[model samples]
Target: MTARQHDTVGELLARSHRLGADPRNTNYAGGNTSAKGLAADPVTGQDTELLWVKGSGGDLGTLTGEGLAALRLDRLRALKGVYPGVGREDEMVAAFDHCLHGKGGAAPSIDTAMHGLLDAPHVDHLHPDSGIALACAADGEKLTRDCFGDSVVWVPWRRPGFQLGLDIAAVKEDNPGAVGCVLGGHGITAWGDSSDECERNSLHIIGTAARFLAERGRPEPFGPVLEGFGPLPRQERRERAAALAPLIRGLASADRPQIGHFDDSGAVLDFLSREEHQRLAALGTSCPDHFLRTKVSPLVLDLPAAAPLEEAEARLRELHEEYREGYRAYYERHAGPDSPPMRGADPAVVLVPGVGMFSFGKDKQTARVAGEFYLNAINVMHGAEAVSSYSPIPESEKFRIEYWELEEAKLRRMPPPRPLATRVALVTGAASGIGRAIAHRLSAEGACVVVADRNTQSAEEVAAELGGPDKAVAAAVDVTSEEEIAAAFRAAALAFGGVDLVVNNAGISLSRPLLETSADDWDTQHRIMARGSFLASREGARVMKAQGLGGDIVYIASKNGVFAGPDNIAYGAAKADQAHQVRLLAAELGELGIRVNGVNPDGVVRGSGIFAGGWGAQRAAVYGVPEEKLGEFYAQRTLLKREVLPEHVANAVFALTGGDLSHTTGLHIPVDAGVPAAFLR
Candidate 1:
């Protein structure tokens, strides 16, 4: 086919990216796009009309040509004639698989049938938050007609499948001039002869809904904000989140423990603080796309501003129990005997009166995704209220989408989860150097990391770089202060329920000879390097012991601990003390399932605050070389003549904390690029 006759897969992918990039339009793999094209059959070598649609389990924002599954249009259309009635979901999926043009590619989206039947060259479907507000309203059909006139057809709520496709096609046939159709309690569909026209139709429909809501004279877009409720500063909000995390984690851990994420964004806080939050939030999700992430509804808690921790904890337990009972009953009432077993009865999002929103998942990323969708759901619900009473799809339709085989199949096709999928890690001095590398590596392995450092601004910067509040949290920690260290650990526990791994890497260097060093200089080095490590380790042990789950503590010691240096008396003495502290702590805490270890790294100057704070220049002076040549000098000192990097040290720390050394503790691993003088026997 000529390019003028049909849109290419590249054009389709670009359309998907534009639609998916906006969360208000579509969230977390929630939308689908398709284009009609021609391709040669592998067997017959004859040109055939093919539909290139967004594949299952692929995000439209990052869609590629390879991510689109090509299917024979004739085969997909023939299925309607083959079934002739309410088609079977299983057979439809199998038929789509049979029509796949390539040997192995992503599975076609569940909406392929609808896209194939639409006749338009380009079709864009999205669960835009504004449009869904109108789609799920009690008078959604009336609202759709009022907003878009006859340009948009209204299809009542129908469980998406072969039947839904047929319904959409039937609507199109009656409203032949319409540019799109609004699926009640579902989403909007816009189609045109070109991708640009489809996108314009989508934006027009969404804008129409927004204008309709604004003209409804609701005075304000959101609900009435309750008195005595306001936003909390970031640090204070984090502290509160930390205090509530263990309780949520413990409750969610009934079958298997999960990491908890706190969302105290202004939007979340505003929604939760509303006087009518509890009554309104129970109305269920605005669209079926949110069913998988947020379940049926959120668990709302009545936490008073003046409530103590104990009282709040007790209330949380009661609310969780109520939520579980409600979930079980909802399942029992809706699920068919032949349906797959129900998913775990856990609340994905929890709304607390004074604490904002908390989302739970097996890991940080998943939890954050849930939080994001829930926030968007709030926006839709608010919009619906502003226009009229908020109405959701019926319970039966929700049940069908939640337990649909195709949806479950997409999840099943995902790659295996990482080893530290649900684990939580806290790394001290993580603003830069080895500590920063460790934090990033741990997050890459699926652990929720707490970036703690004395440099509060730097810690915040690091957390932002690691993907913000979703994956990492910044905490102001001065390890030398017991109170600050305790608070930081509390924040970590709150951010992710409980800490599973602690890396004590905060240190300072003093290279003056013993006779030349002032008492103040000597004390400063020992206090930060030795005393700080001791305090942080003790607090981490206390938390792990209380959690009743064996944890890991990895101390970042130095090569000088094993090899004496003439001018490095204070630093050397402190490093030696830290190494001994790890061994002793391991012996004492091992019985509690806590593993303690140490990594002795030598001359890791780059990115490290110690070297940045004139330590490199001091060492360079001693070596009679320029400061820039110090790294080369250290590299040559190693047996391998290779420069050791902070990332290399991070990998070693990951090895110890991530079950590689589970059965072995009290060991000091070297990460100095095979330095003969620093090698441990």
Candidate 2:
């Protein structure tokens, strides 16, 4: 597990691990786990999949840098081969050759094969005891029969190997949209694009299985309790774990990513019987969790509490062949044209028949995450079973996780926009028209927006109407003067401490004949629209750069910049320059950590100076026509029939400034209500 160093991803990974480690799960080992990064991938530039997992041997609670092993997705899929006599070692060697040639201290897990089939950025796999119990009994078939009914396809037991892989592949192939699979007399599996979802599925399955088992009543209670075996000494464990004290405290304190456990307890010891234990041991994991490790169950020796490893290994081999044969037959029956065979990825988890359990993954971190999830399920299952039995999702529902296309789609899709509780933005000329509209939109999305405009009263009025200083602040600013722009930004920063977005909406639309246009006319338009935007961009870039944060700058240009318009030379030229300045600023600020973009709109009719006031009277005077006649003139420009509003321009501006485009440095958008199309006609 290479630490994210950054707090966001690190914390997600930590939470995932803690959840997996519940003793309610078969979280001891041999599962898979993963997380999406906080920052989107720069290559695909999508804000998803910064992290992921392959749970092998370690428990999530105990995971560290050595636990997780990373691998390229493309390489993980290529391990497609079946060797009847060859063991897990040979198969793992092949996978390692391709996956970890130079990963330097990192390796892929055996479960990597199945995990590769998933598309989610975050993945976790685990097996709890109840799941295995249901998977192993003669009643196992009946259990699956009753639990899944028509929803899940119960696969007969098969030896777990390439052929078993082939069997699961068949189910997956046939379903095409299932969430996961169930081995007859075996465990269940579920998957999703995110860790929260995967863990949720794991819990849901455990609940159902626990319910089914509880119906049978407490088995006549006669297991050789391993002669009063107790949990590992907490004092000794805590003392040894002190090496991680700093990291643990930092994370567990609600400040950084925390690492701890909710799975260590006494309930697990008394809840399950030898038969239940035996059944699960024979069946393997309920699902693909504990993936290539633990051949469903572990070696169950009635030995002394502290049995040695030597005897355990001897006992482990006795159970391997049965697992193999069952896995093979499972493949023959279920695997067909529909399923993608489990091409032997690697083997980390193995059932030893009661020496507890064991599993291996590419890295220790992955092992720990799997282990933790396993334990969590186990503990939860035990408790749920104890209380009114565990009633889990039906097999059909489980199968959805077992074979979920929706989960696959979520994995493949990029991350969505985060909740907008912490964004700070400034909307220039926000007192009226489109500027005011943009400010409203930003505020609605949870951003603290500064309505910057020369109309102080109007800005204040709108801001107050929208709910005062908590969400919006009114700043009377003159875009033409650098000093004014600076003061406005300074005040906003003083209040909000920073700005992440700048929507430059301060500009004028003066219609003067080309022959009569004066230098002053052009200067007035350029100073506020072009130069004003430039000044705002410089100050924003400086703040963002110093903080090592990134921001977006949006200029509201005009559609006339893209084509010729009658009697509007000064406004057109100023808009064209404003648009050009956006690009230049984008380039300059790219290194400084800021993005610049523009929206060109020709028709924006809200409560504007022209439309809200005496627009019909003034337009009639200018055109020497009746007040009502001008409506048709404006309405005829767009093919949509609906007149364009300032809110429409605000919508486009908002989309370009947030979500993943926080990384996109330069671009221009046209929001002219199809005016350009009409112009072309």
Best by lDDT: 1
Candidate 1 residues 466-530, lDDT tens each?
89876889999999999999898888776676787889899888778878998898899889988
Judge candidate 2 against the unseen true structure and give its global Cα lDDT, from 0 to 1.
0.54
Backbone clashes per model, in order? 1, 124
497-598 per-residue lDDT for model 2 (tens digits): 356688888877666677877889888878877788888877666655533456788888877776776666877788888878888888887875678888
Give Cα distance to truth, residue 136, candidate 1, Å.
2.1
